[model samples]
Target: MQLPDPSSTRHPGPAPYLRIATEEAFAPPEMLEIYRRILSGANVDPGFRGLMGFYMSSPSERAQHIMRCLTDMDALRLKHMDDCGVDMQVLALTSPGVQVMDKATAVSFARIANDYLADAIRRHPTRFAGMIAVAPQDPQAAAKEIERGVSQLGMNAVVINSHTQGEYLSDTKFWDIFAAAEAHDAPIYLHPNSLPPGMYEPFMEAGLDGAIYGFGVETGLHALRIITAGVFDRFPKLRLILGHMGEALPFWAYRLDYMHRATVKSQRYDSVKPLRRQPSDYLRENVYITNSGVAWEPAIKFSQDFLGADRVLYAMDYPYQHAVDEVIALDGMTMSPEHKKRFFQTNAETVFKIPPR
Candidate 1:
């Protein structure tokens, strides 16, 4: 199918836009080497080996794969922006976030990653804005880095990968980090990574088919934990953004609300706010969901219906999925021009606070 030309007279200038979530804009040689090591070591599992084989066919192909990964980080991001008419991108640290390491290692890696991202934004300020990566393992350090990232680096928000190395965001231990984020008025964008070791080992043992099924399930549960823990109640201004269409939470929203409403016998915790409204209500109010991996029209429409158009934003998952295809899918969907405008451009601009061009 011929996609509509965003630049055509029918579409006029700067047709709406698309933005990417949790993309590493710069992968230094050292970083690439680290990723190569990880990918190579990740082959301990036959399923992982097969996946890596699909990604890296030959020994000579490793460099190209690494370059492709880096290009996916930067050049391909821009190429997608051009193809999708994305005016600006809110870039963030890629998966597992800074949570996967010990405190010292996490702090060091967060600094390195944030510095690289900051430098990339400096070089392409118009095209990219940054999201700081925090190591919630150390709340005070995370708070300090967040302050530096925003005040010093001009980063717009923070991107956290789903569970903090198995410690869910709702854990009281990380309350200080949430408090700090609330203080800064910066949104937290939560992206997903592999499930913590034993948690999803059953699925992995049966070959990696579970990755597609389980990652979203685990991440969705993590997001739900935040809601149940009343994180939003304490930090009313704290904004949380979830990618991959809220990791499939939108579809199960009604069930969540029903379960909460039906459980009156467990009212022993009367001090809690009673979850007074629908679970989805908190999601609509405190969370912003991005269209990253799932680009289907029905899913988009359902997300907008559940979260509202203003809470939805365009996001190309990148490397995993092509931006060109995402643009074509979105353009082909049947939605009002106004809703499309909000989904494609306006909402992200408002959320990320991107300056108008």
Candidate 2:
């Protein structure tokens, strides 16, 4: 099949990065309808303008708005791949996963979401792959869903929001879900959703909130909690993915490392093993970062330097950022061709087990 030409248009640089993140494409119709209603003044919430402004000002706004119908999954995958110069995309259900629902409801939604995603991959094997959306609210059910998604659906990995409703992933109750993920050898993509209650009040007070502040703060803390909890020590082979430039973690790696190293009392957690290594070490070894909403040269280079090029992947954070602009931004960077290739494609392939084209 003939894929779309990425270089057809004249741009400042090589075509921007081809996005593979979940939110851009997998936004369920129901979610978009809710967003539309909110945007159209139906809800008129106090935070509506801030939310819309962020969405409109994102670098990949055009790509982010394209929602796929459940029945047209194959066409959507092909069209997205062609338009974005994406050779293969690892799919996952959009935000919050099935975590918000009760145990039974979460299990049902997860089966439906995974089945739908698997069907998309089945219809276009070379163009798409999938991640299981499990409900962390119930560990047993979450494990079952992970097993089903990986064994039956053939999903490559799992995608989860930083926290479920209000609970962070560090809780012991969620260990079964992690164990299943580790057993299946599927990485978990840690994307951010809304902040838990009271968490964003400080940002709200400053009038700089939502994705600009809240999302990063919330997700960063979540990632840190996993590191501090020594979850990686327990599941050393488990790979975790962070979107939007590691959700601000990369920029603060040095400080985090220093703080962790300099304070002895702080190092004493309830875990069996001590955090002998810096937080950045775990980030480099066990975690992967993506260039989603962030496209600046300095930020990308800094993240690559800290996490290594092999740990970075390209993401557009679609609907929130424009894919075209993201590609344009990366193309303009002065990074080596090999590094760029890894960021655009190879790293994701390795992490998600996507067969190379």
Find the 10 residues in a row with the least total lDDT in model 1.
Answer: 4-13
**Residue-wise C-alpha lDDT for candidate 2, range 251-349, written one tens digit per residue:** 888898877765645656445235757788899898988877776778889888888989888776644453454455566679887888788777777
Mark the regions of model 1 whose C-alpha exceeds 4 Å error after superposition: 1-28, 32-67, 71-77, 83-85, 208-211, 267-273
Q: lDDT tens digits, residues 1-357, model 1?
A: 443343432321344544434333334455444444555663343333333334444555543544465435467667656655555667766555456555887887888888888888888888888788888888789888889888888887888877765678787888888888889888988777666664656766765433377667777878888888888888888999887888888888888888776654467565334665667888989999887766678888999988888888887665455445556657767999899878877787788777756
Candidate 2 lowest-lDDT run of ten:
62-71
Which residues of candidate 2, in runs, are more than 4 Å off? Answer: 1-25, 30-81, 205-207, 266-273
Error of 1 at 250 (Å): 1.5
Give Cα distance to truth, residue 339, candidate 1, Å.
1.1
How well does each candidate superpose onto the true structure, as a TM-score? 0.83, 0.81
Q: Alpha carbon lDDT of residue 30, candidate 2?
A: 47
